[model samples]
Target chain A: MNLDLRIPMGLLFTLVGLILTLYGAGTNGSPIYASSLGINANLYWGLVLLVFGGSMYILGRRGQRRMEREPQKPADTDSGAARRGH
Target chain B: MIHTELTYVDWIIMLLYFVFVLGIGFALKRFMKTSKDFFQAGRALPAWICGLAFISANLGAQEVIGMGASGAKYGLETAHFYGIGAIPAMIFVGIFMMPFYYGSKARSVPEFLRLRFDEKTRALNACSFAVMTVFSSGISMYAMARLIQALHVFDHLFLVMGWPLGWIFTFSIVLSAIIVLLYIFLGGLTSAIYNEVLQFFLIIAGFLPLVLIGLKSVGGWQGMKTAVASIDPRMLHEWKGIMHPATNPMGIDIIGLAMGLGFVLGSGYWCTDFLVIQTAMASHNMDAARKVPLIAALPKMIFPFLVILPGLLAISIATPHTTTTVSMQGGAIIHETNIVPPEVEQGRGLVPAKVNPVTGKPMLDASGKPLLDYDMATPNMLLHFFPTGILGLGLTALLASFMSGMAGNVTAFNTVFTYDLYQSYIHKNASDKHYLAVGRWATVGGILLSICTAYAAINFNNIMDTLQLVFSFVNAPLFATFLLGMFWKRTTGDGAFIGLISGTLAAVLHHGLSLPLEAHPGIHGGWIHVLHTYPSDMAQNFYTAIWAFSANLIITILVSLMGKPKPEAELVGLVHSLTPKPDTGHATWWRRPEALAVLLVVLLVVLNIFFF
Candidate 1:
């Protein structure tokens, strides 16, 4: 539960985004983008993904830092009240 | 259709996705120590995570492809699947039913039934649900593998490796099944939930671009509307022709749509089905659990755009033209043609007719017109617009969807089988550690069974349709039993069990007697006798649900009145009237489940009117 899901999500997107951005740059004017109507969709969408992924990574790191700085609270007080076993 | 190509960059992108998914499973491995952890994520997930997983678990390949197919066939009317069919039931469950589920602290939906009803009812539900989930997962596997083969996604790679072209189906199926099996086995429900959230975002990433580029190609919404209007102006509006069964593309009137889909089948699936509810049940507390469905409802409603718009785009865009090039591969002449959907007629647009595999001819309907294979709408759109790099991403998204969907069913199956069937019936008083091991084995067994079913599906295509029909029959009357049991504390186990059996029988009987027009006298109904002929299959399905639900409700009420009810003391948390209201804890008024439900309802109404 301590592991922030966004950290992994952010890493995956950032890596894919980087790859896409570089590929788009290398193939900018190539005919490979013709199906995408001559627009470097990979470049633009990759940048968009990069920004989103970067923010998620930053936010996740911040959340993790905050959790570490604060004393770890019990996961939930109400969990004890809820039934546990079948 | 010409096979789309993938470059090294595309391969890298796809490989990165696989690495990340498996990495998360490994990262979460140590945490999954207990049976609770394995089956229910230790009941520790936060609302947003659970919320996304809640929707994503249901957002399998069938949803992505099926909705797109429906969008092409029914146009904006397809929004009814969310607007009227799904959203209300989701809101209803969150607001009215979550307390009973989360409050009673049942491990699975069947367990919940056992607490509120009896052992017999639980056994009936658990067995049916177990069978249903495995088959559904298998169906997803089959669909994904076939789609890969149809798209020729790995054909070039297979050829390069000196593998037969037919092996792609087996390779894709086995590979995806193993991937799903490994993750779930490693991290249990937590991995599935985490991967589902990732898959949710990836689906958006993949399809959102398709919609944008497609709209831009066709000059945005206005241009797309104009293009669709030329096909059928009614297709542009969601409710224009919905007053009569024969008029609308869906061939269902408001009553059938509201009662059958919205009230019966929708609630039955969203509220009672363990696959989705299990995600909500994994939340940390009652408040978070309540918020899960409400949170999911927002994205769930908006998904029409992400999924269905591509279908509209597929049909609206200019007809695809194929250019063939002949080349020599291993001294054999290879004719490569660009595989895009072509318009057979003016209104048909890019939708292609269903072709007979053996005869290599278009399949004709009872009306003599060719049957349109609307399932191609989304795949063709992905292939048409995306270049190699993004195409790989798009296909990965599709594969991710299939895997997550399979994982959802597998997790749900393992839980039900472990807790309800194995622990309760097969062997009682087993150690917690013993059950955890059983759960892991169940996960493996479920995937293997799913693989067998997937292969079975490949050989017998009607098996999917037949299983779906059987599930609907078993599922349609379910909400009524739950509704009475939760609200009316007087309902007894005998009443529920008999009511459920009778309801399923009613559904079978109804389906057998009623026939959809332009269909044969078998799976399409009317096997017993053609007493009523529906205008469309959708109408037939809705009415079947309505009949089954009505019969169950009436019979359940009648039967319950004749039986002795459980004592009030025993029914406290299990009954709606007896249980106290759930506290919102530190949540703001705006963030409360009821408030969110209200907001979702308003949004649903606005969407209906906007599209109307």
Candidate 2:
């Protein structure tokens, strides 16, 4: 799977799982509360953070990989080394 | 006359516990080969030990005593302080913050500031945190001493001391402080971690029995439920009664306060405080550091049930009629109006006239009238319930908690002093040996300062209240600067420094000025009631955190824009560094969208069911 798609998918599943756990724990009410809200508040917020976090993680990794694959400027290397020391 | 005395078994248990603790410190001394070893445990602590130490360091006399008191007063809602107030922040620190810190190999939080910003910001933070550590340590010591005296374990030591040991209070404080100091000074962070692991187990063992026995005594879960129901239905509801203006002093909106506390206080403490971070930083690798919080999170979730539930149970078992009145040592009652309910009141003078039909103990009021002081509720429960040997074990467990917390604070102070202050400023070219020596001296100084602060903490009615207030006034300001410095490249050292100082000043001034208005309004005023009335419980903390954070963000942004921007290279490097590498594996469950989504769901559900 493409890294971007894979990361977001993984995050989606995790968010769903989190929502389920929260619902079970009584953060969201049993089925009754969900009906009142006309939407699952637990599942909704849970999925948001999950998907966002996962997408960010994946995007962040892809950017880093792209940077690494590109030719390194000598100046970049020296400055990177110096910065790392500090 | 009836004589109450500690048995041989009690003495033996106490002796063994002391020796075992001391032995752990001494044994780990050989590991103190370098300054790093002493301060950061050679950066080799395992994830589990770090996690255990983190929990133990936090579970001191202040938490045990204050949480118990809160449990007696607030019921299940007190768990929010432990669960929401503590856990999420810890998870954030473990998942996001620690990886950055450990991967970079920064020795202390202030040192991280020095790298990210400048020396002035580092120094400012170090000084503030140092003052805070000393005060916190002192409070821990004082609580330990008070608990010891209350237990009356030293009544038999008169012969050893001579002169009827009139100085037991001073003696107990000094003795406990010295023992804790000796181990920490000898083994540094390594000993602290090792001792904390043991103490963590001991505290659990000590409290578990109380919960079990208390549950049984109250006639199992049904009985407990019925007893509590008979007293107050709010006792079972975790989130009800939390919003009442009378209970909370600062007139804080509970939802806002809970969120602010969870995000700001949690992030600041778990991420920024060296006392907690030192444990994770001591891990063998970044993975270990990251894992520490996850490993620790389980216990963190479970402990409130063990510690706080018993206090609630104590409330259930204590009868309104059984409450005794408090009197001054001079045998004079101070006042009648101070009367409190008997079941909740602890020491003399706060309850209506009453005599304990069982013990024949006179319950006296401040004016020799019978009154109950609910503060004594937990202690009275302990005295009534536990057998002699178990009581000694419980007392030792309490002491273990104090020692563990004291050791963590002392070690952190010493580390910051040795690394940031002493090595950096005092003796820039000092050898490893010299640094190690200074580290020991710093530990000693930290202990002495803590002892003094502990004595002062005694005067404060509630340790947790004082601690929360201190965090609001001090640490909340630092959070803005640290977070912005990490994420926002535009934040200059000048901006960070100015924001921190201004935010702190605002919080302190607000707290101090608000006190008088809260105590007595000059006029029969309606506006005063709306504007000036603060929620009595944690409103100060909520208000301080909000205002302090706002002040910090505003000052930082305003000052930074006016100042020259950081070099593009530096800014780019910082931003780039924050971007997680694919191979680091540090960006796992925590950063996973699914996990956070699930967590939020859980959080919302818990809030809806338990809170709303």
Candidate 3:
């Protein structure tokens, strides 16, 4: 399968969000950490994973669109025709 | 509360459950018209049923008993095994792996291997997986039998059969085996799936009451928390406390170990294992197949709440009142705390005498008398805490768990035998009728073998310890081969085959050699000092997996590089299947990319709060 860079990129951001949320939550008790983070750790990490998984999916769809725009190869056209015959 | 002695009604209830399972199998026989229908449920299972079956397949008797033992021993961190170890791996499988397996019109994982690689690879993968399934089935059988005996459901069988108490284990195994076999034989995957769905609902209904009643008996969640705190403050901090050497038997880093196991063994079980993949493979189309994973994820996410929380509650109720006692063996005073209370050590010859401060007599009960037994603590709690009908439900749930797990193994075994082994090697030219007959026989054979294994499993001291050992031994290496195969295109058949064999052997040797040395470091101080102490069996599993996979990957890549690469066209089918398509268009059932992205963010945030 062709690599979808969009999904991987989205996943990277999601992972970062997760790490930040974990950092925030781990320091929930300390006033300094809580004020700086502005969100509890649990919600933060949850949000991060959700976003990461989500973005990859979106990027995957977008990559699919770009690939569709490219000119079809002779081999691809032949296979498509063969499938139609079957 | 029902008496410790199970009444006639309990036996009747148990029998009814068995009959109901068998009945479902027979009832679903109409769906088994074609080989495809029998093996893949005609690729038409609904999302909810598939999801339930997926969860049910994973929830075996071993999990229930093992989780209980861990909760008693390790406090709340034990829940991580269920939550993090199982749930996330399942979610990953659903999200990522499902699309690949289900989208491809493959009958079994071995079939996929055949498509991706060659016949030799398919045969090797199928046989290895079959062996693992048989071994696991045996373990599950033994665990379920032990639970039944504990519940005293086999006293009648002992009398009727003119057998010893040991026969209770036999009876339990035979009963479970026969019931599971009857269904899988008659209905195949369709029967297994429907039964699993029913069993899943029954198990949940059965356990919910136990948790609720247990909490009520313990004076609610806060009271339970206080009880646990009074015993050990560390119990509340699930993560940090889990890291302690005393808490984890193997003494390895918890998160690292769990995630490693998750990546390797978890991927193999959820992603590549035919038993799980078959459920999704039964979907009518690619969209339905895709839906299987996401729909399944919801149940996987929720199961720990039912299975693991009750264990934590059990620990909270039992911990504070726990006591230490001396054993007569070497006049050794074992400082037992949490779960093993003084009241528990009345009988069974484990506990030794301690003089009373005032009475100058053996430490006794309220009447200044000796206690009976320590092992009855969990059982006593069940009888006292849960109400009558609810107790039946709890026991039934436990039994349902066994049925679900066993049925999955049996179905997978039958599929492998019918398609890969029997049809491929034994009777390549056999008719459909002949193959179907053989499939039924294979199911029966699987049950009998598992029963024998279960008998052996019972002799082991603790069920959970045995299960972890079994999983680590097989899954670690199996995971290595599948992971490499899935991603690395250059890996040749010879390399794949050799790597799998070598990785498996290495993992077994490491587990056998390293485990004993770790357990008795005093006897082998030199070895112990050199080899780092691993924490839980899960950690050892991770270490073994890493070593095995590393060895396998290196060998596979090296050998492949030296040999010929697979033709590009050969891999096109697999590659194209995974490639997302634009013009194909999206269905309403498909999660919106933006919404999914948000959910991913939320999941990560939740994980960080708990994990970090």
Identify the candidate with maximal TM-score: 1
DockQ for all models: 0.38, 0.02, 0.02
Mark the regions of model 2 whose C-alpha exceeds 4 Å error after superposition. A1-86, B1-5, B159-163, B241-252, B320-375, B455-471, B512-518, B521-531, B568-578, B582-612
TM-score of structure candidate 1:
0.95
Worst 10 residues of 1 chain B by lDDT: B339-348
TM-score of each: 0.95, 0.75, 0.74
Q: Mark the regions of model 1 whose C-alpha exceeds 4 Å error after superposition.
A: A70-86, B1-4, B324-347, B366-368
Task: Score chain A of each prediction against the true chain A by TM-score and list the results.
Answer: 0.82, 0.40, 0.43
Question: For residues B1-612, what per-residue lDDT tens digits would candidate 3 score against the true structure?
Answer: 113334343455455667666766666676577777777776655565676677677777666655655555455665466455565566665555554565445568887777766788789888877877887888777667766776676675677678898777766777777788787888888788877766666666556555666666567878877876776765555566456556543354655556555566666567667777777777555544545655665565555556655655655553233332212224332332344434333322222234454764456566656633223334444554443223454576678888888889888998998898888888898788787788888988888878766766656545545555555555566655555665666767777777777776666656554542235543222233434555445565667777766666677777777878677666653544333431224534235322443464466447535632
Please report, as a value between 0 and 1, the fraction of native contacts recovered by candidate 1. Answer: 0.36
TM-score of chain B of each: 0.96, 0.84, 0.82
Q: Which is the better candidate, 1 or 2, if ranked by DockQ? A: 1
Better of 1 and 3 by lDDT: 1
Docking class of 3: incorrect
- Clash count in backbone of candidate 3: 43
Residue-level lDDT tens digits of model 1 in B500-604: 998999999999999998788999999999999988999889999999999999899899999999999889888877876676645678877888888888898
lDDT of model 3, residue B171 = 69
